[model samples]
Target: MIRHLSSLIMDNVSNVKSFVLLGFNDTMNFRVPLFIITLLHYCVILFFNISLVLLIVLDESLHEPMYIFLSSFCINALYGSTGFYPKFLSDLLSSFHHISYEGCMLQAFIMYSFSSCDLSILAVMAFDRYLAICRPLHYHSFMTMRRLSQLVCLSWLTPFCIFSINIPITSRVKLCGINIQRVLCPDWLIVKLACPEVKSNLTLIVYIFHGFFIIWIYTHLIKTCMRSSEDRVKFMQTCVPHLTSLIIFLFVMVFQSIYGRFDSTDSSRIFQNLIAIELLTILPVMNPLIYGFKLTKIRNRILTSVYLNRK
Candidate 1:
């Protein structure tokens, strides 16, 4: 019997090309309201992130390393947000919630890659601030435009390649179930559908690597910031925005992980979905604003841009 079941499971895993997402189980009265609110939220995310990107690109005076990082940061927000919003909106309007195997993998990749890239960019920003304050003499030569371009590319591509490896690992898994418990196709929920023995090790390994990388970067950042009042001030001026975005992102992820694992079953589907998506809703809109308002160059450029439009 066991041998027969193993063959059946293997056959199903290889042939399955779609998943039924159960995360959007809502009553008729609430779906339209939820859809409208989500649409507005997506639009707001795009407006703020894109506006910051444009402001950084157009103003020659603001083309320094810090602003360049912030622009990439905004562009990343757009990239990540796009991965989730359109499909979600479509599901909100649809009577059934289903995603093709390839589509789900692509979404999962975008979601995880976006998260990994966010931290990678933040780490690069932290490094930029460190050299600017702690090693000011060499900052210009070290952070030349060409080097910044390389760092930006690294930030974007490294996480992508790292996370993309999960697809094949997942593809090999024999799923005993096809029902995803959430409104979205999150990486973990998909893994949960796999047979009991397939232990989603690849996702866990990538997360561990990302954790070590973040710890190393932040340790150096704190160490350098402790050296002198000037260094501390520089850290405060430049690193604070990056730190804020990191904290908020981590907090949301932690809360969602905890909530989904331990507390979500008793909760309503809508509330559970909210918990799952809190990071998506907040980070894309907030990061650009946090950097734009806190950094003087970006802030001044924004003010000037507004003034010019008014004139």
Candidate 2:
């Protein structure tokens, strides 16, 4: 019996060219319908993000530092959606499950790089709002077009730099015995699969350190906003979306870290399932809704733009 069981396990391993993505397996019967839904969501996010980005670029009235950073977020979302949903949509519609190892790595790199860039841009936006609200008198001079351009450039550049260093180092290592569990390879999960000697390549000490700086700056910005009684409404209105996104991101990261320490058992499988779907699929869908629609100004701008374009 023991020999038979061992043989069965080996046979299963040998025959398994790729692991089935049980991530969205819950929607098994509704794959086509779910694809349509994902398509609609992706279209809405793309339209709104591009519309806002165009509005900022074309309308002089919307060219402040706040709008500048908002446009950056839109661009990030545009690329981020492409990084994730294209493959997801394809997988759902045709039930295409096999992604080459290279393709999976590319997807992970693009997804993580875009997400990290979005975080940095949001931090910059928070700082912009902080200075504008806290120092109204000098807001214009301090956040001039040139300075805003520099900040935006830095925000975009920093993520690529970090990813360029970390992704190649981590992804180049072998994963001989590891099994990919989903339709996509998560960058961090790929790292975890690496053998011990090559593990240091995946240790993102610098990324973690910079992430803390972003959090610290954002914390100060939040405190500044809370302290100003006269500018309270405006501060909160501008800062709340950023604060919410940041909070949710940090919460997910914390949960992922804690869950990652557990044995690879049933509970870990549940955590993995939740993380794969929510973090990769749902988060991108929710991001534009949270940051764009919930804001009265952006909501109106998007509606007005769509109406005008239609006419």
Candidate 3:
């Protein structure tokens, strides 16, 4: 009897070649409108993020550490959005919402890394702001081009390496099911299908540390800014956008986590789908806009270029 049960479990594991995403099952009536709206949303994300990245790259004056970090942030947004939107749009138009095992894993990797990298980059940006505002005299000496390059590389590489380890660990788990409840495959959801015990907590710890560091830096920044009017103005101009982005990011993350953990069957499918895609949709569009409008140099450069081209 035990042997027979083991055989059945092995067969079940072998059968999970692809995962069926059930998030779109209830959207049959709205697929056309949904597709158009999602397409337009994706285009807007691409345009804004790409334009900001280009503006930073083409203009030499914007070559300071802050603008360089902003460019990296926008580029990461583009990377994250591409991983989600194309497959999502295709699934919207098709009857079947199936994703291959490889595709699902890749999507999860891209998304997980993207989020971790986002926090990492934000932490680096906070550090940059701390130096510029709190230690203006020593800012250039400390944040040399080489130091900036190392931080940028660490921001991108560290997350990618961490998630790279996670993907393989998840892949080795013996999955008992092939259906995912959300619009896209997240590693946690995939892990949920594991037939046996799966223990991993490194990513969570690393993320918590990143969050703590950012808050710590900002705490010092606020205290210093409060004492001086010049620092206060600089904080309003440069730091507000970072704070806004951080707030938006934290809000979306908390919302998604709550929904994912306590997701009730009675909840609306539309609401669940929105919650699932909120990170992809909102951050990609908002970050670039926030930075472009908030940063004086980038704002002035954009206006000057536009005015010149029209003439």
| Highest TM-score model number | 3
Off by over 4 Å in 3: 1-11, 197-199
Q: Give me the candidate number with maximum lDDT.
A: 3
- Model 1 stretches astray by more than 4 angstroms: 1-14, 201-227, 260-264
lDDT of each: 0.79, 0.68, 0.89
lDDT of 3 by residue, 1-311 (tens): 32443455457674566777889888888999999999999999999999999998999999999999999999999999999999999999998777888999999999889988898999999999999998999999999999999999999999998998889999989898776778899988898888874767877887889999999999999999989999999999999999999999989887887777787878887788888888998999999989999999989988998999999
Worst 10 residues of 1 by lDDT: 1-10
Residue range 1-311, candidate 1, lDDT tens digits: 32443455446674766777777766446889888998999999999988888887888887899889888988888998999999999998987777887898888888888877887887788778768876789999899889999999988888878777776677777677666766777777776777674555665565566667767777877887787787788788888888888789778877876775675477787787777778778899889889889988888888987999999
Better of 2 and 3 by lDDT: 3
Candidate 2 deviant stretches above 4 angstroms = 1-29, 94-96, 196-207, 222-227, 261-264, 267-271, 282-285, 293-296, 299-311
Q: Rank by TM-score, highest first.
A: 3, 1, 2
TM-score of 3: 0.94
Residue 185's lDDT within candidate 2 is 65
Query: Each candidate's TM vs. the true structure?
Result: 0.89, 0.79, 0.94
* Candidate 2 worst ten-residue window by lDDT: 13-22
